[model samples]
Target: MDKVYDHRKYEQKIYSLWEKNGAFTPKVDKSKNPFTIIMPPPNANDPLHVGHAREVATQDILIRYHRMKGNSTLWLPGSDHAGIETQYVFEKKLREKGKSRSDYDRDTLYNMIWDYVKDNTGVMEKQLRQLGASCDWSRFKFTLDEKIIKIVYKTFKKLYYDGLIYRGERIVNYCPLCGTSFSQLEVNYIEKEDELYYLDYETLTIATTRPETIFADVAIAVNPKDNKYKKLVGKAAKIPLINREVPIITDRLVDLNFGTGALKVTPGHDPVDFEIGEKHIPSIISVIDMEGKMINTPEKYISMKASVAREEVVKDLEEKGYIKKRERLHHSVGVCYKHKTPIEPIVSKQWFIKVKPLAEISKAALKKGEVKIVAKKYDKIAHHWLNNLKDWNISRQIVWGIRIPAWRCDKCLEWTITDGVVPKNCVSCGHEKLIQDPDTFDTWFSSGQWPYATLLAQSRISNFQFPISKNDKAKFEDFDYFYPTSVMNPAYDILPFWVIRMIMLGLYATTRVPFKIVLLHGLVRDRFGVKISKSKGNVINPIEMINKYGADSLRMASIWGSLVENDSSLSEDNIRGQRNFANKIWNAARFIFLESVAKRGGYSKAPTTKNSYDLKIIKQLRVTTKKVTRLLEKYRLNEAAETLYDFFWNQFANDYLEKTKSRRKDAQKILDFVLQESLKLLHPFMPFVTEAIWQESKNRFNNTTLISSSWPK
Candidate 1:
């Protein structure tokens, strides 16, 4: 029984052999078309979690299935230098040693980070390797690598030169801990219980969930179409805390049935207020600072944090003549995605990408059938975000990221941007004194260029051989060959932020859709449908699972728990079932190997008149291969894995294995065929175990390793 399938010893040995043999490299025959996928790069500071494992398994299955179908497949592998997250990690590490990031200069700290990554990156890579990722690791790219950063800067300059990127002061999300501005997608909406303060509006009353924003209110808005508040328009109302009189304006954006018909417009704090402020020029009052504190407000509230100011404002409103009544309310509040803290929309000068131009191209691409979404139901959601998309905020006030290439000369105060960097002398005044933009490009700005930036390294190394370069024509060999990649597989959460922006930038740069198909996987949530978060202590560590059971076992478990189109839970019971299934395959392989060796190559001829057992097994093999093939083509990897698992364990190992044990010759043929086909189907999911067993018995079967071998015909 190979001593109960020694997974630990065999998993590494087998994987190393596969790597040595170049099994992951595609067979580059011009006759066969290439199938490619750029993996969603994960932050390297942490190990792979259950959520990440599921995504990797899905992609691996697709790549392996396509390879078996004789298509040249390339599953490009890489990691991201997650700017904020990684910076936080290193800072924490420094803090533990009683030092801060400021102790070292940018270059010194950056070198330390690179050194840390060099030391720890192999840990996660080895974990992924154990899961049997058939990624061409030799072609791996890092987002912060010199080549990738150059490509990122080049893309940024192109957009700036084309006037698509601009800087302006606007209300944006501010994270107190990170001390940086976040994009709209970087904020997650959560329901919170709060009080709706109904304040006196002349004779009537206006209820508000955020009474603190009243300090910054520029105008009170009522729906233009609502006759109930039509008479209240063009009137003046005194703010409760600050006795400032703001004119009441009517607009259609207000929902008459929601809370009170009168809505306070805090032009410098709220998005809707910004829009209203633009329509009707009103007195601007910015009560909040970048640190989310009241900068300039009523006397008692000056220099207070936003939350503290809320309490003071509420109490003052209740004591003053403006407070009519209050009611408990539950509503969605936007919070920073990383720290889960409420985001403050404080106005600040930042770079933004005008989304309308890119959005039109994205919509046209989908409408013209250039981009396709799997499952089809997501099309409406995609369209809704695309149609109503606002301009993307693309700048961050942080130290550790790609610095803005544009510079401002102090002498002439003229903004200048060269292809790579601004010249030492100012173009206007011939002054050598120039200051680089203090802000960094947003993280998404770099990630948006991932699909093309990956090729930048190859482009540079190959001396601009790739078709994505400035001088290279789109009709060039490489672009025509791999320009429109086969598919983009990512989580559904990135639909608005990353996916849509990539579609727009890819079209602008390559003049084509980045990939032809988008495979959106649902989140790996808990059993109750709540996301497994680190704060909630519900996060499952993949490294712990790998230590207990081998990575192949953990990977198979993830595949089993995953549903093709819906969020699924990673339960312990599910993983145990997967372990048992792996054992079943191992035991069956051992039994077949012993029998065939004993009979000195047992079955040479294919059996014609088969028993019910043989027919049932053959029929299952045929049906399973066909189903898995179709499912893989459709990117239903979880379904494909499920189909293979059930057939291999239930029908073959349980019923068929016991039934055909006695009939040596006929049984061996049936077992060989079923086992071979099952391995082919399961190879992508559990490459280590499958290849280990296949290589051990290669003399009696096929010559190639399971990794590179063609699928069952």
Candidate 2:
């Protein structure tokens, strides 16, 4: 704790000193181009998980690298107002006090949440800072911040007035427990063993896992070419519960070999059914309600929840001559992330954005290479999403998000929409009382506009960010410099959601792609390829890792674990090895400093610009630096980190420093260059420790600080 490579003492001292001295601030100029990355802010509800830490560390490395390269860099830090997650956390807290979110009024509850979020945000910020993130903390912006909210409103109004936004009845992934509809991406599908209930539809017997949905079944479908069910085509089968006659249809959409060679079309319940409804059976009645239970399916199964109805319907089917047999089958069902409840796609009147036009623009941009995907592998993924893009449903029936600004007029019954301040009276009706729409914008609605909104705080734009001219009116100097960002480093899971949306928004607003490169990272799983989870008792606590091995060590382990493009696993042993690497750097720096400190405290000789020793290290440094930089440019973060680790730990610290220690008389020059170069290289990944030793070394050749030192060009 006193000295001697005490990680806690040095890390704390170094961070406090650097922050106080504004070490993370990158010099900005209208003339010099800037490097920028908008961080994928996590909701401040939970503690910083390992996955979150990896992203932060990766972003930090990019930002710091750019900063050292003399490019003005800004890592915009912020948090999303995660409606469901934050609401759940608050609800849990309130429940502990014997209350519910519904118990409080919306405004009062919102105020309470605002306080809660601010407090939670502080905690996360501290954790990120402790991890040595070089983000410009002074420029941090939250999604709920007044400025961001205004941007959201402005975006909504622009999109609405342009006819790209509308309200209509559509099927959405619905979770009954949460009483809300989820976006497609929010739904998780899990394969489970379910019962395949055989039901005799007159002469044709069909199998179904969800016997409850049999009441909602519009038509029993068989493959057109299936000779077995050829005679059953055009025949009507009476449903078990309501006894409503449904025609047995011949359609190629049905798989002849799947589930007794027959399929049921429940347009109101499933996506596939909805598609079939659009094409073949539009007149079919929907018997299932929003809660996934039988609504108008008759008295026996009506009003029961879907889960309860599953059992009841099957029992009745067995007793009433409808059941033929039941067999076990493996099937995939969507589940909500929070509640783990099965997600049912139910028809609902929600707002949607006409995304085809936007998607076309995005597709064109990528086709033109205006928006370059980092990994190149993402090109296929991007193409898949854009080519098969569907209209985006931007509305959510949640209380804790940006409220939809459309309002229905009492007199005219027509909706008048505005993103500006709510009108006291409806524009059409002149009614004194106007009701604000209760629906909240989907989380992605706000997220989609991040690239533009964060830059210009506007939705629509008429100009690009390049070729700076006096006549141009783009707001931020940084935006102009960094617009059409070099890369967008993010996870591949969001290719359809956030990544593609950003590209589309960029094309719509700026007539260009948001970023030229996109670095994709894989998920961090456990050693055995199983995902880390608290319930499974296999989750690694990042906080505990930090306390034991220090933040730098944990980050290094993350780098090491990121061996490939897809899912990678981390082990405690690997983290400890990273800690050892940090200790090695510290010990080497201490050794050099001790010799210099003992020699009556005078300046040591600087490394000759042309010496073989200097050239060798410099050449190696250049090769290492260039290789790592290129890798990062390509969004190969793990590869880049690996390169740095090998060079710094293996070559510089291990080989060069050991030799330099023996030649103590001329060691001053070699030591200075090695320390400076190593610090410059390691600054991105291990900021605190490097800067701590850089300051303590006392062999100052230049007046420039470690944080602002130029990267080896």
Candidate 3:
């Protein structure tokens, strides 16, 4: 052993050896239980950030540990062609070159985005390898892969035929800059200052921040509990500049205390108003178009931008005595999460999934304890979201994703939903001149089916890029064995956005829970506890840390910072501390080499010895092994890692090695036994350094690799 552990030299070499020997791939033993984790496929748009590193470290620990436990373990990997995000990123790149997506047609734009994402996906995969991820690259998948799209299409057609999918003109969160509509979950609400204008309706006074939407107001609503507006509820209120006499209505959802207790029911702009309008109002008007410009109004306000038209409308209201008073208000406004622009609520005919039924199935499974949640704190939260589940918008006006497999006939204008390809003719009208819908499915809609789809895709595809240990085992039934994966590990922040959807869709499509365990991790933050983001300039490039301190040190540091249901902080200082731990481990290996004790006995069990130092280390290793193994089994990884660190640094190196320094060979059997077992316990947490130490002792131990070694009993 070298005096110092050179991580850079040994890390790649060991990883390549593991790959060459097919240690990463699982064996097809029907006797052994299968343990699988379908990796939360990261976006294919940009290089991974620190958050990605944290995710990889957490999953890898679980994967490698399970593999050693003699389970048929699999960590399947994939990439996401993140629908709206990728298109938005591509457009930004186009702008850098003084071009726009509009400069290219749909096919040309899609092709360009595909090439860009392909290049980035390759770069991201290399980064995953650098982090020592042991996922099966042979079965790697992409969201846009023809195999994946087929599964997505299958689900879509199934839901459509089952009456769970429908097309309706409903209010959706539309981003003008992105030229796409986002689901309600995709909007980010921000608190900002705006002017609230109290308008003089003939019958009642109404206050609103958006005077530009007066043209679209079909009714004025007053809370039924508010006695002040009881008489005006049945009367009509005249609009300000539009001079339209819309009926005043009573609604339970109208707030009695919010600004004069009279609400403008512009169903075209508000989700609550849209729900109320569906019950009372017969006509819906959209004054603002999808381009963020005023339309369907008088000529003067028609072409003006919505923001510019707001000023014009306010001026007109004041000139005509329609404005009663103006006051400054600080309120929450929903905006597009990606572009940070106010999300325009517009009525668009889009595809939707009736998710409440699916949510019910998932909720029942949760209540039955079919799926276990880590930390147990998110149980009530998961139920809360499941209870409030609503219809999901599944359409995105983009060209970069799996386009909706539906066609509209030029004759009957009815849709013909098919399975991922254009039909010969419209099923509704038999029209040969049918046009396919130009929209694509929302990214989450496809990703919701990730666990089942990926496994099914793998089972169906015969060829593999890097076939793992073909001679060891032929390909067996993967989907039947791994359809319901062992664990679904994702960040807690996306628990509602992504995880909940996965459960709902999984149950609806497969009639089974996607995974038995929901092991929720948290965000990777900076030392000051802020989220590591490129926009905040706090992103610690994971590759830089791996280059500085080895990937082993980086992985250990990541596990150190993370706690259950809490954001983790990774600092350079922490990584350096872990590097010191690696050095401590290396120094112990060097000390053993210098002693020249050639008898490296692979003790299956601890030896009973009269020497107190030998007996004490053996007992400590047993207790530490049992405790650490239990913690990891329960998904308490941080506690398990802490236990490992304490046993190795404090008990083994500090006490036993120091106490037995005078007569090393006298305790060689016990010393080698404890050291080898400890290496097995720590290999899952820090693979490279521990495996390097084990490989050094391979000659004496009959050439057994630590990775393929069994867990300490």
Candidate 4:
């Protein structure tokens, strides 16, 4: 044994040995129950940050623990072709080379991005291996794989035929820069200070934040309960600067206290007004184009950006004596999550899924305990989202995702949906000249079916294959065994974006919950509780941490610092402390091995009952073992790690080892027993160091590897 512990010398070699020995492959034992977790696929376009590192560490702990407990454990790994994010990254690269996506056709750009993501996916997998994640590499799946795409298509076709999907011209949250519409979950709300414009029209007043949208106003809405606007409900008011008359209507959706008790109903520009206007108004007008430029407005504001048009319209209104009053107020504004640009509400034709029925089933599954959420506090959050769920928009105007498998006939103007192949002729009109839908399915539309698609694609069932037409049924044996996986673990930020949708779609497609347990982890933030991001200049690279400190040290630091349901802050000092703990482990093992060899001939045999020191240490180990097993069973990981740390460092090293130094043979036997059991408990969190120590003393334990060894009784 060396006098000093150096992690760099052993980490890579030990990791390679474990992989070569197939330590990560699940044992196919039908007698034991199965445990499965589908890794939340990271975006393949970027390197992983600290958040990804935390998930890897936390999930690896669960997998290793289950593997040792005699379960058929499988952790499937994958990556996502993140639609908007990947396109944004490639666009920047194109600009550097004096080219753009517009320079080529759709096929050319899609193929280019596919190659780009393939290279990045390789890099990310290497990083995961360096982090010591024991996922099943043989069962790895990608979202864009041909077999997975077939499953996604099958789900879409099923939804469409079942009357759950439809195309309609409705108001959508559109990002002009990305040229795509986003679901409500994808928009970020930020507080902004803006001028509230109160415009005077004849004898009535209308309040609005966006005077630029006045040209599209179809009516004026006021609360029906407000007595102040009762007499003017049937009257007409002229729009400022446009000289257009629109009816004054009564609707309950209006907030009576906000700015002048009257709202300009611009159905084409606002979500709340869109619903009210669709029921009460006769026509809808659009004054903004898809580029977010003022389209049907007056000459001065035409072709101007929405923000610029707002400034010019406000100036003109003030000069024309139409401004009743103005006040500065802080209000919520929706922005694109990808580009941070202000979102524009535009009415466009897009595909949508009726999620109300699906959410009902998901909610009932939670209530019935078929799907259990850890940290019971999150039950309310999951219920709240499910109860208030709206229709999901599942279409995007991007070329990098799975194209919507619908075709439109030019001769009869009818639509035909083919499950996985392009139809030779339209089913509705028998027209050979048909154009496939230009839009693509939203990225989440494919990802929501991840659990079923990934498992079914890799299944051994020969009956389930790709290019499945609408007439063919899709079923697989792997899904029958692993459909309701053991757990679904992800960070809390995605509870709405990814987790909830997974439940809803998983149930709709498979008629079963995706997982039995929903384990929600919090974000990995900086020391001050601020989220780590590249734009904030606070990003921490996990690879650098693994290079500096060993993978085991980084993994231990992550577990020690985090609670299962609470955010954890990262700092250099934390990693340093964990590194020191790793050193303590190595030194403790060294002392035990040298003492056993020198004092008791070779390895110490099991000791008989002898001294108070030996009995006390054995009793404490039993108690620590029980506590750790209970904590891990309840998913209280940090508490378990902390309990082990204190017991080994304070109880075993400081007290027992010191007092028993006089009885060399008895001390050696007790030390061997304690160290062997301790290695088992710590193997899940610190695999490399514990395994290295266990292998060095191979003659001590019948030459069984610590990884495949059973947990302490």
The lDDT of each candidate is 0.77, 0.74, 0.86, 0.85
Q: What is candidate 3's lDDT per residue for 187-209, written digit by digit as tens?
A: 89999999999999888899999
For 1-713, candidate 2 gives per-residue lDDT tens digits of 11456677777677777678887665567666688887777786557888876777778888888887878787777788887778777878898999987798878888898788877787788888778877777767677766566667766776777788888787788877676788777888888898888888775777878778876788877888888878878888877756778878877777778877888887888787777776777854556676566787768777888889888878878878788887889888889878887887788888887888988888888888787766567789888878887778887766777877778877777787765577777777788666677878888778776765676642244333322244564445555666777667677788887998888766666666788777766777877878888887878877788888888888877766454357778778878888888888788777766654343322233346655665677678778878987886665677887888888787777777766655676656566666667677788887767777777766453333577777765
Judged by lDDT against the true structure, how good is candidate 1? 0.77
Candidates in descending TM-score order: 3, 4, 1, 2
Worst 10 residues of 4 by lDDT: 597-606
Q: In candidate 4, residue 685 scores what lDDT?
A: 85
| Residue-level lDDT tens digits of model 1 in 562-612 | 565567777666666777777778888998877644432323333465588
- The TM-score, computed over Cα atoms with residue i paired to residue i, of candidate 2 is 0.90
Alpha-carbon RMSD, each predicted model: 3.3, 3.8, 3.5, 2.7
For lDDT, the strongest prediction is 3
How far in Å is the alpha carbon of 499 misplaced in model 4? Answer: 0.8
Clashing pairs in 2: 374-518
Clashes of 1: 0
Better of 1 and 3 by TM-score: 3
Runs of candidate 1 with Cα error greater than 4 angstroms are 1-3, 27-29, 91-119, 200-205, 226-235, 240-243, 258-260, 315-320, 425-431, 461-480, 526-530, 535-538, 596-620, 666-670
Per-candidate TM vs. native?
Answer: 0.90, 0.90, 0.97, 0.96
- The residue ranges of model 2 lying beyond 4 angstroms of the native Cα positions read 1-3, 222-235, 248-252, 260-262, 280-286, 291-293, 424-433, 457-472, 476-478, 561-564, 595-606, 609-626, 648-662
lDDT: the better of candidates 3 and 4: 3
